[model samples]
Target: MAPSSDAAADGEPSGDVMTYHLKAEHELRIEVDFDRQVTVKLLSGDAEIFGCELPKGGAKTLSGVKCAIFTWHAAQIQIVGKPDACYEAEASAAMRSYLNLHTALEERRKAAVTTTSPTTKGPRVLVVGNTDAGKSTVCKILCSYACRADAMHGGVAAAAGHDHWVPVFVDLDVGQNSVTPPGTICAVPVDAPVDPVDGWPGEAPLVYYFGHASPGENAAHYKALVESMARVLAQRETDDVLARAAGLVVNTMGWTDGLGYDLLLHAISALSIDIVAVIDHDKLTAQLKAHVGSQGGDVQVVKLPKSGGVVTRDTNFRKRARDRMIRSYFYGSRSELNPCASAIDASSFKVFRVGGGARAPNTALPLGATSRMDPLRVAPLPMTRDLERCVLGVLHGDNAALGDADVLSKPCAGIVCVTEVDASRGKVHILQPSPGSLPSKLLLSGTMRWND
Candidate 1:
């Protein structure tokens, strides 16, 4: 049966509390209003947002999330709070194409096993599109399908004693990373379906901090991180048979013009990508085909239609998303993690900024010198009020002997958000993931700051 809605008559506006009864294989698409919050709960049956399953009888609040709640079987759900639009839609044709691609990859994986190939190369998919083009969604679906295939084929357990067949998910979009905190590039191993609402659970992702929200802001640093991630993925593929057969699903940022285009090309070469799926843009597809063809690389450029469910997000919405990601890092998606918030003497820790606080304009720089600053240059920052509310990356290296460049190049152990800066008492209160003294006194500061 199709969903039947019932609104309350208690003087509140309609849709303030609405019930939906979704038939099997139906989805409830919610396009949330700008700057509005929506709360949804599974009243009966089973439904999921993204990869995360909804609680059996509990509610999940989404602020600035435009998503589809889908179920393979019949389910009913109740939604409170306001939404700009709400409707039901069957799975699109693009989803079918994605599944077909997965089927082909599965065949290749099986063939490799049968032939006993030394170097098994499965599908290395790279997803690229403009902002809000649903690149991440495509990647998520592909990863989920791969996980499901593993489970069905008895890939869950290995003859050599392993837990599951883990596929590598390389998140190159540092600003909106699915596997780790914002401002960091991560390569996560996904063995199961991701949480539909909560995203990739706080797994142990290999992260490389880029120290900025946008790749354009720190192009050199971003490129370096991408290279690092690609190397990591390459090494993992060589070492693990399941990982090599499962291959990689790389998610890129939505900067498809000029330098962004160049960065995409760089990633293609660096990752040795075999398939490039260009979403919803004919021009981008043409450009990628031409570029890849000219280079004589064995890359298949495929154009994918954008989903009707994809909601275009504006600047404010993007900012809110970033903030939410940062908050989710420390507090978790369900606010279940108890992050430590304590005041420490400012003199106890040394804070440093990377890339000399952004590059100076060519006109402002000395004659004959390039405008771009050294990406690995780190400068010590004096404790001040400006440092308050800034996110600081706790470095893994020792503070004493490391040079400026070494400091910027090192990966961070964790991060802390400055809550208060007490100059009078020389103390700074910070919110961190755990209690007690920090692992390292050397902290790396960046342009990325989270108000929450």
Candidate 2:
């Protein structure tokens, strides 16, 4: 839903919304003109018809109809010849640029209130996401004078040092809107809490929404939540009373093959410019190889980490990341079943099973995919593949949260999910795609207890 009840459609020229990464794919063009008709000439075995031609005081659209002016909308751009071509291309490209710019602007505007103030030479990091993706741990470990996050969750949210601020939340699951308070985890110091008194938010980091919900879940509600949060954080960056931090460290919600790859991509695009992915060595190397840029024949790709810190009023980044950690620990996963230990990061991307008789890797199959895994079950998708497409609804049922997420491995447009389960212990850990051959079907039943 729109951030405001009064807000109209998302800022884009509406008719059909086609989400494609033009930057990574193709350049669009268009043309228009005021001229007369010459004749209809079909060339190349009548394969390519240049134009139908128009009358002197008339115009022609990209579709080849003659008129003073005409508007054509299609993924394949219209190329008119000569003067008209220049004008059409200019107008079409200009319009699309404005359209995308407007969409980005409007999205930010709706969520502007939630952005936190900035820090010094880096972004005001706001830690968000589901449990165990290292949201709080990362914030606690973040050095640099300007780096801070309000990561503590739960009651009496008081961190000891510069990173003592707490995370805030809005009820976005349907009608829930009450502010989330700190919980048990925030009170217990898994490690020494960052002392907030040591460093005050010199300038608060701007606030931004961080979430772990898969796409098509409650993500859209973030627009409204962000707006609300921005209002409180946009204040002076240094004000310390529950102030927000500058950077947002979004810990993903992954447990036993959840946090689908598509979800990760969406999060990277939405929350972080730099995706510090902790995939296994092979996958990372493959991505590095796939860096198809013209800069000296690829591999110069950079996610572009923010050079300088941000400035905003949200100063309690550490505490917030901590709080989110607590919430996610308690509410997001099958804590009873798996009993998560600690979060993982680049350092611990691989999980080792101590004593189950190990089976060898499955190299007999190929790690290929398709856009649709099972067309019969999947919703009718448009011809194009849009990663942003998601399954809607809270993943609250007794069934596995990953039922839909498994679609990632489909060839044409799939997520690339990697499930890790300790069948011996009836435990599971959904992970990002690790390097290897074809996947071994994680037998959740027959080997694992179906119900808790």
lDDT of each: 0.77, 0.25
- Collision pairs in model 1: 49-196, 50-196, 51-195, 51-196, 52-195, 52-196
Model 1 lDDT per residue over 295-322, tens place: 8888999988787788887787777778
Deviation from native of the Cα of residue 249 in model 1, angstroms: 1.2
Error of 2 at 242 (Å): 15
What value does the lDDT take at residue 281 in candidate 1?
A: 94
lDDT of 1 at 26: 72
- Residue-wise lDDT of candidate 2 within 122-233, one digit each (tens)? 1222223232332322333232111222334332134424333333211222111111112100011112223221111212222222222222333322333333333343
Cα displacement (angstroms), candidate 2, residue 63, comes to 70
- Model 1 worst lDDT run, 10 consecutive residues: 151-160
State the number of backbone clashes in model 1: 6
Candidate 2 CA-lDDT value: 0.25
In model 1, the runs with Cα more than 4 Å from the true position are 6-26, 32-64, 71-84, 112-118, 151-157, 160-164, 345-347, 357-372, 423-425
* lDDT at 329, model 1: 79
